[model samples]
Target: MSTRLGWTAALMLSALSLVPARAQDAPKTWDVPMGGNSYLTATSADAAKRGGRNDRWNSPDNVTSVYFRVDRAAELNIALRAKVPQGESRIRATLAGKAVEKDLKGAETADVPLGKVVMKAPGYVKVDLQGLKKTGEVFADIEALEVTPTGKDAAAVVLNYVKDNKDNNFYWGRRGPSIHLGYELPKGEPTEWFYNEVTVPVGSDPVGSYFMSNGFGEGYFGMQVNGENERRVLFSVWSPFKTDRPGEIPEDQKITLLKKGEGVHGGEFGGEGSGGQSYWLYPWKAGNTYRFLNRVHPDGKGSTVYTAWFFVPEKNNWQLIASFKRPKTDKHLTGAHSFLENFADRQGYLSRGALYGNQWSCDVKGEWHESTVARFTTDPIGRSLFRMDYAGGAKGQQFFMRNGGFFAENVKPDQKFTRESTPAKKPVIDFKKLEGADLGS
Candidate 1:
């Protein structure tokens, strides 16, 4: 059996005691605007499924081209949203008289690439798109289109393995990192592998966001971003049993917090460009397998693991429990950094050590299971956290939950338990009740 979940990691130091508790209210409801324009439109015809006909095509030709006349001379960003298809295509851009092209390579079909078509002086520009040939078939589905002003540097960031699809209850929330990017699992089709992608404007300080896949059974997933140091940063998580969305976490399944840490801007946390943030924390309930993900900032430089704490009932003190199993696997990867997750009473913490390889795994059932995987950025700012409440630890283990935290160096630890021993209050968050909160930009 497999389980999947999505979450975020943030780091904050201080809080207003006796202060107005605003963040805990509820998410406000917001209306998402319809993106209808000549520049972008949804292509619903010529639809195909995985291993179905027309599945190899990146996107219906109808939505692939942006129809715009060049006024003077400017660089435009061509954003393509495609679920994992079957093959790769070389992405190209061209004007009435000029053209630029790049190879967009991948294994499955959901790789999203922000291809750029530069229009120089007085002529019309048309960006062309195609995939490169590889050992396996691969394709990308085109969704939204965006054009941005690129100063001299006109390279578009190509994103791969996207999870945005139709039928999802999506809405526009905040800008930058506070922005919430999510999707509701489709009811009819069984999702093979879900992917998600977000581009934080060129330069922005990202706080952190949440990834919640509240569904029964385990849903395998991951997150990645391309920017300064694309291959250095890494984040991942998993769910052992099953449950509903974050708003529906069961009372009996609420697990304790484990450990928490912050990866600051200078050392391994921050890389090349301007310093960034890194965080690690894990939240879990007993006997559940959750999907794990890893994401990178569109503009930050660095990555690190964050703080962790287990969710204890009534009593607020973070203590260690021996009822859950640690993550284990025989699968491994090359050139990537990895972590092992567990709980110390109520505190969630990832061991200080991580492995680098082309393949990696969390030991489980005294045997190794091959894992579905993805890659991450190098200059990662923030940390990765893992959580689980199962039946064993280390050596022979079973994974109950694994989560990743990014740009979370801003969230402070939970306020210290009140001196007066009050029963541990359950954290209250209800999406149905928060429907009145404003979510529109």
Candidate 2:
């Protein structure tokens, strides 16, 4: 294998780098050490009655405490999760001296905004003693608590380290209500890699404009367009091609818009947000255009994570896009059409689709992963097309890319014309001699 091929295999297994937790900002967390066989199995009950049965509910610790010493007033976002029985359990967040209740169901993933309990002052925020009860004994697992800064100046930081080059500073900016971010592929790129995770501060609303793209064959891409604005977010892989074969494209293919999830392609629009992963492909286009959009934000810091892999074609190169938006007290994205209600299949593109449960449409694979225009390459180029791998088992996790490269190709079709089979005689000479002279007389 070539050096580029060797590096592509290396980036597949490792985790990515993560922003270090600040010494001062790390919140004090204590795990509840409750241990024993489950006292109760599954049962159905309401919120207050479920707290009545001892067998149905239990806490890691009888009590868990978290203290803070903020020098000044600061806005912070906090996240908490627990494994409780089917019925509702009474949970509380006591800040300074007041308490607020929260409800946890197994189906709802732990998102910063989901079961959020906010505090405005500095002091200890404690989860009070439980009033949980149920028929049988079950484990109420207490997850971790995370607190981070939130403000106009508070930005999500991303550092891309491709091959051996680091210092690729990727900056995302919030302009009024829109976001802008991009990066340059390193000279020595890698294939078969994953995007570990991107962290964002809490208190941010679900993002509306989600878009991302890289110049290569499509990889597995995902888009989570939840929340009330009902805006569409797009995340896709892209390339330029001329034939039906996969490796037909060369290393110089330009990045363009690949797969896209317009309007509310999956779930409903509400104040709530969700996250998940899926696959993607870039439709073949004649012109080479680098740069695409992932129109939505990763569902906050802990909600979105992905893993993808690309075959190292003959070339290797790529970049990433991530974003977020805060909740709006007013009307959302103005002048934008409702993409969900009036979606039409784009002409001249190969399309497939799927719908799961009630709200999600899994069209990225079963249907929408291919392009109508057939293009491929057959070159021994050193680099490979992009690859992506994703797993969301653990929230707030990171990834490390070992080795990779971007694949690009140039393939455009040439126009061809056919001549008529039979030749025409000189009929024009007879027409000129026949009628025009008589009309003048």
| Tens-digit lDDT track of model 2 for 1-441 | 111101112222211111233466444322211110001112235422443123223532333333222323445555543444454455555544456666555633242232333434332233333334432243334433444445542233111112221121000000011111111112221221112112212222232212222212222233322323342223322232333333444434322222212221221121111221223333211122222212121223222222122211133322222222222111111111001110111100111111100011112121111111111111111111101110011111111011011101112112111212111211111112321112111
* Model 2 poorest 10 in a row by lDDT: 168-177
- Model 1 ranges off by over 4 Å: 1-245, 261-357, 360-441
Clashes of each: 143, 75
Give me the displacement of residue 276 in model 2, in angstroms. 59
- TM-scores vs. true structure, each candidate: 0.20, 0.21
> Once model 1 is optimally superposed onto the true structure by TM-score, how far is the C-alpha of residue 300 displaced, in angstroms?
41
What lDDT does candidate 1 reach at residue 16?
Answer: 22
Q: Report how far off residue 357 is in candidate 1 (Å).
A: 6.0
Write candidate 1's Cα lDDT for 1-441 as tens digits: 100000001001111221244453332211111111112122344442221123234333322322333334665554443333434455544433355554555432222445556555533333344433333344333433334445544332221111121222111101111111112232332232221211212222111222222111211122122212231122222222233332243333322222222321111111111111222223332122222222111111121111112223344332221111112211211122222221111111111111111121212122222222322211111111111111111111111112222111222111111111112221222222321111110
RMSD of each: 25.2, 25.5
Q: In angstroms, how far off is 145's CA in candidate 1?
A: 12
